[model samples]
Target: METAELEPQVLANRLGVEFYLVRQNNTIGCVITIAALEAHFWLESRASDARILKTFRNGYGRICAIAERKWLARPAATRLELTPADFARR
Candidate 1:
């Protein structure tokens, strides 16, 4: 797959979840779990949905980068869930 600039968008779903676009080719469902946010992005466990989105937005750049890398590694995956381990330093 071509390394196109994939812009992330807010997919309307239940609380504690969001999505990122995979360009014109396909839509990649990226799930940033609440546990990941709490562990990696300084998000409170009881943060509201708005707060959750805000935290996700604040770390959007890095999160998207990691998601993109994972997507590249497994191009055929329609959905990818990101965890705190994904953000851990190697």
Candidate 2:
């Protein structure tokens, strides 16, 4: 499935933000930490949820691509977390 085709429902938590990517009728949980956002995407530290969502939206394409690659690597995994290294690799 193409993660870019779907607009994920984003949620904020104590650690960071979480979203889902659908693949073959399955929902794969994905998370990107606030620290990753700040370090890689220029998100402000302690950003508001709205701001965080905006950052995610701004970087949606790249983020989704990475998530897609990860999902393809581990299809059986129900959840995935994006780290600074993931962003840094590209």
Which one is best on TM-score?
2
Give the TM-score comparing model 2 with the true structure, all chains together.
0.81
lDDT of 2 at 36: 80
Tens-digit lDDT string for candidate 1 (1-90): 334324343345533466665556677878887888899999887777778878888998898899999998998888899888999999
Question: Candidate 1 deviates by what RMSD?
Answer: 5.1
List where candidate 2 sits over 4 angstroms from the true fold. 1-12
lDDT over C-alpha atoms for residue 90 of model 1 = 100
Collision count for each candidate, in order: 0, 0
Error of 2 at 25 (Å): 1.5
For each candidate, the alpha-carbon lDDT, in order, equals: 0.76, 0.80
lDDT of 2 at 26: 84
Which candidate has the highest lDDT of all? 2
Model 2: per-residue Cα lDDT over 1-90, one tens digit each: 465634454453546677788767788779887788888899988777788889988998888899999899998897999989888854
Can you give the TM-score per candidate against the true fold? 0.79, 0.81
What's the residue-level lDDT of 61 in candidate 1?
89
